[model samples]
Target: MTGDHYFSAQPSTAIQRRDVEFTVAGRDYELTAAGGVFSASRLDPGTAVLLRKADLPPAGAAGPFLDLGCGYGPIACVLAAVAPRATVYAVDVNARARELAAENAARVGAGDRVRVVAPDEVPDEVSFAQLWSNPPIRIGKDELHVMLQRWLPRLAPDGVAWLVVAKHLGGDSLQRWLGDEGWRVERHASQKGYRVFRVTR
Candidate 1:
């Protein structure tokens, strides 16, 4: 394996393409995958857990949903598919991941609904109605906390964030930290060694 982590802004390794298939909410998805992105060979287990446990937005739920740390756009695509009226922002620091996310969103015919962008490109004035993430935990706790601090506050007053973190990877501690930060957090579910957290301000 290369030294590159999925959170790397620009993965320097050579690209190797593959395909991944998974189902969410009884709908099957087959999307192209490749090297230099998160879980390039398969659906990430934490993401699967998040999708299975989190409450997906209603069909009529409106705009400005966020898929933080989006890798290959699985969460964003699924959200757009489920709530076509919503605008899903697929944000990532990785350039290649953004490219793949755009491609996958287009492949799923969510091109109009899913907007893949670099994290910095999202306008600060925009508040999200919903947020979803399988956060990049290997990036170190401090960095992870910084990322959460930056985005979690962008939730609209009634917005909710769905997050999944591995139990062994400070999931419980993160929950406490969110509480300390004044966000109401709930342990929505625990499955496959992952903690699904529902966060709100």
Candidate 2:
């Protein structure tokens, strides 16, 4: 057996593929997923809470949005579907995840707007109107902080970010850390052991 984490840059596991179905904003989505990606079989619970509780972009909102740590483009696809005028960057470190995300975007008719890419491939000039993530807390506190520090600053001056963390997984600490990092952090909602944070400049 291979010792591979979803965060692995190249996962050696056999691609056991499947489709994951979920509904958001009263619309349904069916996306393909595979082994070696985060939550490959289903929509992650924290992400589900984030989508359900946070303020989604309006249909008229035009954005260059970011779905950080995008597993298989669920958040990216949903954001693209809801905000048709937006361009979504679905970024992940895992190659397999990126491949599935691209395919899923096309399946959802969001191929033109959703750009599935690696973390480093994002253009330096791009700033996001909104950023969404169910961050990889298992990556450890220091690594997670580094990840946040890297991406959170890329938000446009008036931009907002929505994030969900499990309370059991240092969720409250993360809120405090974001505040300490000088962002205005609001506890947007709490549901089923997850803390949804609304962060802004």
Candidate 3:
């Protein structure tokens, strides 16, 4: 991976930690971000839309959940906060991102329940009840598809994945591809030029 890419295993960008504040499901979050992570300047708009539009697991929900490509663990933290019984896995390629995610999860009091790790650290035997992502579309189509292929099959038989992609960035095409791959894909919501897909096996 490119040294500057947020998908890089170890980002070379200068570390500059800062706080990004946002609200999801009426709860507030102030996550720590650094130079090499995704959306370090603010709560990414696509993620904002996903959390707003998608159905978060209820307070009583139990899960082995996933926040794929978790940058600084915003989604993972939120999932853990909302579903106290859930174990939320925050997976990322960037080591810096993983570190920040761990710190952020602890800040949100979800550290014990949120596992922040490298993508390869996830066990193959583990299956997810739900998955969420504001995918790194800029990573290029083939890489993005490969990433999805690696993770989507880990979903439990009845599990669902929530994804947010910019409309200009092949959201519809991705929906078609998922359908072609035999998954049921629903365009759950559209806002701020982003498309939210709810996918199931």
Q: Write the per-residue lDDT of candidate 1 for residues 19-120, one digit (tens) a residue.
A: 899999889998887888999999999999999999999999986999999998899999998997999999999999999999999998999889899988
Candidate 1 local Cα displacement, residue 36, angstroms: 1.0
Better candidate number, 2 or 3, judged by lDDT: 2
How far out, in Å, is residue 175 in model 1? 0.6
Q: Pull out the clashing pairs in model 1.
A: none
Candidate 2 per-residue lDDT, tens place, 118-173, comes to 99999999999999999999989999999999999999999999999999999999
Best model number under TM-score: 2
Full-model lDDT, candidate 3:
0.93
The global Cα lDDT (0 to 1) of model 1 is 0.92
- Top lDDT prediction, candidate number: 2
Cα RMSD, each candidate:
1.2, 1.1, 1.2
Better of 1 and 2 by lDDT: 2
Those runs of model 2 whose alpha carbons end farther than 4 Å from true positions after fitting are none
TM-score of each: 0.97, 0.98, 0.97
Per-model C-alpha lDDT, please? Answer: 0.92, 0.95, 0.93
RMSD from true fold, candidate 2: 1.1
Local accuracy of candidate 3 as per-residue lDDT tens digits, 1-201: 336988888888999989999988889999999998898989899999999999999899888999999998889999999999999999999999999999999999988999998888998799999999999999899989999998999999999999999999999999998898888999999999999999999
